[model samples]
Target: MYQLIALDLKAARKEKTTKQKESLAKIALLHQNVQSLGNSINEINQMLMDHDDCKFICITEHWKSQDQIINYGIRNFKLASCFCRKEGKHGGSAVFVSLAVQCLERSDIRSLSVVGSFECAAVKCSLNGMNFIILSIYRTPSGNMHVFLEKMEQILSKISDDSASVFIAGDFNIDFSQDSPNKQLSCSLLNSYNIQQTIFQFTRITSASESCIDNIFTNISPFVSNVINSSISDHTAQKITVMVDMNKPANAVKKRILNNERFLCRLKSVDWQNVFHIPQNDVNEQWNYFSNIFQSIFEQVFPMKTFKVTNRFTDSHHPEKIKNNIKECKDRLDVLYVISNSDNSYKPCYNKEKSTINY
Candidate 1:
């Protein structure tokens, strides 16, 4: 079975009675190099389910256009901004902010970004008066480092360090696990602004080689960073935990479904022998027989769930107001009917459904 295999956020909150449990940090962001997002939406969706409180999700190498990314939206996250190459073959950047968080896309940054050099999409997020900017960056392996460094300086020189905390995360194609000229130059530029690389462990590990090309750099201090298996990408995913609190959606509805890992295990445990050996030879009957077998299994694995999401700013259907108006109209019609039958003076007041009901 695919277990959660970490300090589940809910478990940490509930078990905070213990002194050690109280030290569990709040996970603020999740970043991964999803080579192709269309192929790994389920894995990312399941990860989001595991960490419902997570604020930001950034991915590199999405290989999607703006229209494609719009069509491939995540469940609880909003598309803050994204960038796709206009000239190159593949490689794109996307940033998805939690719907609960207040965020605005930085189109200015996108305008200055160079695709092969410092390809990135950024968003400015505000929570409880604290503001921070997240840059989902990606650089091609064969791309020129001078262009990357020059673009970085141009963009960084424009933004002041004191305005907001900064988080730069994604694949740079420059390994930080070992020291090199490219890494040193990149570090010098970022460190000038006090933004430091947080993930030093090798993110891409294979039988032949290992490298820390995928990384996260942030100006926020005193953070905890870890590399975990994403189960979808060859490069491991990186997550960061900070002391600050993420904005919890007081109004947004939350609904829980069966865990994906558990569902797979339950499917394997079910007995499908009866489905395979159905005695009926009729095609329709055989279809129904298999359907019933799967139906029972699905019921056992996944129960019903109910949830509602209300937008605080706008509403499409004011059902309560409409219901009250309907009730008042019915009462008026009833009174008119009673009066018309009791006294001829009020005749023809109520004859049909819409007889006297004014719009």
Candidate 2:
């Protein structure tokens, strides 16, 4: 019986190891039409916390201005790129890339536009030594579909080389479920460059209607893809999974910092006057003697160590107080939402709280 129990324990350990390996094998990405990130930014944060495996989040219809982006920043992930609507207040797109992923905005493609009717934000990054171009696009329903397609074609033409894989995920506003001319044209345009739409299920579900407007188009198929049912927003969040080795070494510089309090305490305990009374003829020798004593005290009190430089975005500078304030505002909003129910009373309160948090 003891031998059997030991075997069972061994099997459990092996199963646990296998589970850990499987969890580390893939990186999850979420794409969603937030409609207006300003109102539901807290929900996004909660979603991220719940889905810890998600590394990247691509959002469309953010309905946010350039200034508002600062307030909607997430903790670990950095806002790599954003294309806000120039004239109107709505219809914007943004990509938040994880710090673990080395990504930079593709300014070349970003600058190219078709009268600014459509929005697109691209980032070039390497994951596990494999290079990829990730784009988040949002096409306004009012925009000319032909012009949008032509602009997309132009952008695709520029990055059509077989060097890097491309992943485009967004709310195109073109219903792929129905046999529409726009859908056909979009599919044909994508197919011309060997890009395939991976999402087939209805991303936007409503009581009256359902459609697969939100999509994930990629040149390379993702290892895992699914539509997450969420009450965070009206539309469901689409998730794509890819394997990435996050163990890549980072280029970092080390610098020393002194713990002033500890150093002062150590200095207070020393007989400074005695140490300064060194038998030296030259002023330089006396200065050197003083410096050596200071250095010894500093080293003993405040040792130095190296850490990676990971502050690549403005959000990195946000203080803990600001995070706490944001959380408090979210909690208040939740309470107000529950109390108001179907009433419009929560709108004003939410807006007021949002302004306070941003401030």
- Indicate which candidate wins on lDDT: 1
TM-score, candidate number 1: 0.61
| Clashing pairs in model 1, backbone N/Cα/C closer than 3 A | none
Candidate 2 lDDT by residue in tens digits, 166-230: 78888888999875656765775576456788888998888899999888887655467889886
RMSD of 2: 25.0
lDDT of 1 by residue, 242-303 (tens): 87533333233222233434543454464545444656455445445544444455455445
lDDT of each: 0.69, 0.68
lDDT of 2 at 222: 46
Error of 2 at 100 (Å): 1.3
TM-scores, all models, native as reference: 0.61, 0.60
Q: Can you tell me which runs of candidate 1 are displaced by over 4 Å?
A: 1-27, 245-359
Clashes of each: 0, 0
